[model samples]
Target: MADLRDVAMDSKAWPFQEARALAKRYEKAPPEKGHVLFETGYGPSGLPHIGTFGEVLRTTMIRRAFELISDIPTRLICFSDDLDGMRKVPDNVPDQAMLRENLQRPLTSVPDPFGEFESFGHHNNAMLRRFLDTFGFEYEFISATEFYASGRFDETLREAARKYDDVMKIMLASLREERQQTYSCFLPIHPETGRVLYVPMKEVNAEDGTITFDDEDGREWTLPVTGGHVKLQWKPDFGARWAALGVDFEMYGKDHSTNTPIYDGICEVLGGRAPHHFTYELFLDETGQKISKSKGNGLTIDEWLTYASTESLSYFMYQKPKTAKRLHFDVIPKAVDEYHQQIRGFKGQEPVQQLANPAWHIHGGQVPESDLVVPFSMLLNLASVAGAEDKATLWGFIRRYAPDATPKSHPGLDAAVGHAVRYYNDRVKPHKTYRMPDVSERAAMEEVLAALDEWQGEADAEALQNMLYAIGKEHRFDPLRHWFQALYEVLLGASEGPRFGGFIALYGIEETKALIVKALRGDLAHEEPIDI
Candidate 1:
């Protein structure tokens, strides 16, 4: 893990600067703990991918940290903009048909195509909340539909339009001249029932900045505007909502960072104060033209949790939310284990590093460890497997042998499980898997097996390992890797796998021999196995 000092030394402070700059623009002081109101927002992608927690959890962490530092009270509220229209139905979401059908309707209004639950947006929000709760984050989730109906956004919208009218008009004029915008007017005409299409405002003052649009037509209606209609449009409506809500801090991904300035501008015009602090996160799996959904790829928070802890997931959020980083599944487990390491060191549970690295403590929990997992311990287990079995077999063997009989399992138990599973999934194929060797490769295999037999009852991992290597050398195989391949060919029918020495210790000699014998006879056949 990188030390906090080194991370700060190498880090770009652009995000921090932007956050601070916004606060300064608002003329607000740096927030004190327990006294400041922090507003975090999220887009309901529905069935939130890991990135959703990455955005909210980090904000929640920072909010907690800030509260601990001072008397400033803090609250974490996740604003789900389900009100926005559907841009694209995520590949995993059911009802791809709705993506086309609900073109102009509000996203919140769209029915969930799947029989899962409520609307699609609500389903996704529930998933995100589940992930967060697993990590112990306490955030109040607010939906756009609810917030708008409760009158929380009305003041901000009215005030912002009145206050920033000049600025917005100029901005909109420029945007339209660039052929980038459209404006419309609301014309309340009677729909088939003789009721007005829109109930006109009970009273309004367009010239004086006092416009009241209420329910007069027995249905809610947004106020009309100008040579064109002026109700807050889709994007700008969010900014108005934010300003009214007094959102002190919010974060977004790189995808939204570009046009967010427009949101800020709209908030300014609407009278509600825009969020002063914000973080822009990078993309996940955006680089690939094809992202995997079956294997838990491309924005499923559930998949990330399968491999990474909530804190590590939070740590991913803290790093500069840039567009360049790719949070691959392959790299997540180690990252999570590293977070546990940091949690230990920062809280004095573990020994300090021999060298300096980036780490910090806030609200009693240490900032999650460095982004780089380095040569971590749990990973060493996977890296060590010598084709003894696929990750599942290896794991089952370990559990059977070592068993978490003690009150506690090893420090990185979850991470180990994750690594083993992922490794097994990626490398071990039922058919066409890389086998240790065949009978034709026996001369070599026997040599390594003999070493194993000789090393029997050698309880010490290191000593048994050395004996295996010595045997491999006499057989013309690299002594350093002597028994490793032989073990794989005999046990798993593969030339390599997660650590061999550890497996021998974890699985016990009897189990190891049995696995080897099974592979040697080609008894195991190819079939796609289910996760254990």
Candidate 2:
């Protein structure tokens, strides 16, 4: 048996691959900061979305992988740029008038629309913390507002001031000619209005660590770069923040991939090595548009939790970090089923293979034994057929299928049952289109009904499936998917569904026969009726 550490070092899993590079950064000597730092940045201009959560989740996976390969200590930081000015009010939040009144002011200075925190920034930051806390993520939360006010960023701010011209050169090259005319590395907060000013700097006195800029009203004032009086523009801030904290590893979406050079340039200009970056692809909506927090266009963290387990969500995040995935309600059931499938397959895997398993990464190497005897998609089909309104309604069938399983003993399955019921009501029930089976499909289902009549002994899924296959073969269902498709459309009122045999075993032979009779009589309820 190979040592787990050796396996991790050689593992081709993405997290380990990333961790290997991060570990190699300190191969000869550990970080002088005494530990490796992993950071994920959050923009609090709006509520944190699933993508925001993905950054922290992915970073943590790499952090855990690093732990497996190295004995060095590690720390993870969830940094919030709460000091950023509110450029626009988020359409999803309430009290638009209040937010509009506070536009251009720092987020920490704006009034909270939800009235639940000290400021709008605090409200969103609390939302982010609550989200990370819900998953029990171990991270140190840092507020940019406090970091500056408390003088922790003073040295870095002063260094940026000293290297102002160098930072300007890097930023100026990235901007268009028009933007370059007015762009400055530092944004001054108006002393009277408390709004961040984007006006060009009149004077940058590095010796005094102050910048002089005329306000929108044309009044000239100079503010010290330290003590939260001024902030660097976003691009410059990205690198400056890394320098200030000595970040070793950070991962962001592909949208930020282009700005990597500028971030690194500014970080090195401020006398700090740029962190190793991993740029994962952005998530898209059902329409293939990018998911944005402000637009409220994609599935949210709470909405996902309403229908699936958190571990399933983590499992979705764990897969193909480099590839763009469609994050929608339709993807939830598949993620839940696949997550359980990974867990079920974990125990039989070799040490190397187990290390490569997503379940291992998701659970931090302590993968749990899955008790989901029935797949979630199967439960959804059962829910649709039975019109299951509650977990108890589904549990009746579940208890029959796995007689020894109880809610206490099989909590994952119980939770999945509840998820299936809710999912069926909200997603599956709304758009179900049932078609009157064509002559061929009708004959096939009729033959299925007759076969069920002759069916004897115990309800075995495989045996029943074989019987359905034989009947489909007799009915000439060329590809055989045609047979399953017909059953799913006629009986389940969906284009696709679980294996009919497994559904029958769980739903019971007598109940399945009744369901078939209803389908044969064209009595199955559907949201909309269509003819084929």
Candidate 3:
């Protein structure tokens, strides 16, 4: 392992470099206190989803990088905005009528549809914490409801109340004319109806820290600024949290970039500087629409974990956080394969180069030692072809390739076999398309089948790859790339697959030869490739 000091000083990994720069900037002009704080917020309107996982995972990577560069005391606050009003009921949860009845009420005041917690907000908050715990995240969980109820935000609340006109001016500049008439920086909870009201305030007394507003019942009411009587609007709330907690760093989605300046202005007006801001691109679904928890369009965290390892999910987040990427089931196999490749290559790289690799951050700067055996994608294909239902079936093929390998000694591969089994059953089985080889492709396949016997089952992937390419050239397949495509179409019934050499090595030369023979005999032939 390389010294972290060397890596931290010169590493070009974006997250590490970003963390190092942030630390230096903050150290020159430390915050109100000596500590550095990072904050990630979650709106607990629904269960913790994949987007939630990405936010926390990316934040944790930055935190890890920051720790390597600076010895300053640091903390990450996973804040849940549970005090937000329930505008609409989530379609996924039970008891929709109950939630609909509580619309306009604070989330904490709504009854839990699941009946597992005191309130809907509490249940959701608990789910978020549980999800974070599963990833071994180190953070303090803060609830907006608790913070407001405990009077921890009293000072910030009072400050917002005093600067109400200033905050409103900044917020209203971004709103439409019709919205400006009803917008207020402070949303007071109506004492009579127990509903969070968003109407215009009649009067704001800076000296008394109270706001006078009219309720839905046409009654004028004055509420105290503290003790949970009022909650700031979202933009103002973001500022208040930054000031109150002295947050040093936070990242948000690009969709919020337009409003970030307003948040900064509000924080400055409240006598606090906004945290260092990093805006990341949003995660989109297969249709290229933004992933919405309310819409349930994207893959859930549970779905991701079911098909891939957590470390693979972390690797997906590690790759270019600022770039937009579509996240769906189709991404899991590639992500898993990429994670394996990184881990296999970790030990051979130069120390500085290793520092730039995602596996370093994914594994918290400590890369584990492991021999390359088989890729997860290959395992999925093997499981599909073999109809494997358990570890024993996949391990049977693995042992034939690597005779010494054991399930007990190779837990990662073992676990991948299980994930691949489920992934194949759920995603690949229904969509499989096997194409019969054309006249030229059959000639190439015959050459490949003959060459397998000469392999002796001992050549490495590179050697076998060269042999396959030579066979493709010998058979004169147009463009040459079609050789491998022919192999995939014949053996796996897919137009693309794992590296042929690697797949043959793991699936065994004898078995691979038989499968090709079977394909040549038309046992695996299907309709021609669809013209997509």
Clashes within 3 Å, all models in order: 46, 0, 0
Rank candidates by TM-score, best first.
2, 3, 1
Off by over 4 Å in 2: 525-532
Each candidate's lDDT (Cα)? 0.51, 0.91, 0.85
* TM-score for all models, in order of appearance: 0.67, 0.98, 0.95
- Report the lDDT of model 1 for residue 297: 64
Per-residue lDDT of 361 in model 2: 89
322-431 per-residue lDDT for model 2 (tens digits): 99999999999889989988998999999889989999989999899989999898999888877778888888888889999899999888888899989999999888
What lDDT does model 1 reach? 0.51
lDDT of 1 by residue, 1-532 (tens): 2353344233233332343343344345544332345666666654565666666655664554343333345677877776555655666665678666764334555677776757766776676677778877777888876665566655554464455445455346536554333231122222232222223334444545443444443554444332112334556656766666666677665666666777777666655556754546455474653233223466466556555555556555555554445766655655655555555566443322311212342223344433222223333333333332334444554455455522134434535455545544543433324253555356655554555566645455566566566555665564455456556544554555445665566656655555545455454433222122
Best model per lDDT = 2
Which stretches of model 1 miss by more than 4 angstroms? 1-34, 68-70, 87-91, 95-102, 114-120, 163-167, 170-181, 184-231, 270-281, 286-299, 306-323, 327-329, 336-432, 436-446, 466-497, 513-532
Model 1 lDDT-worst window of ten: 182-191
- The prediction achieving the highest TM-score against the true structure is 2
**Which pairs clash inside model 3?**
none
What TM-score should be assigned to candidate 1? 0.67
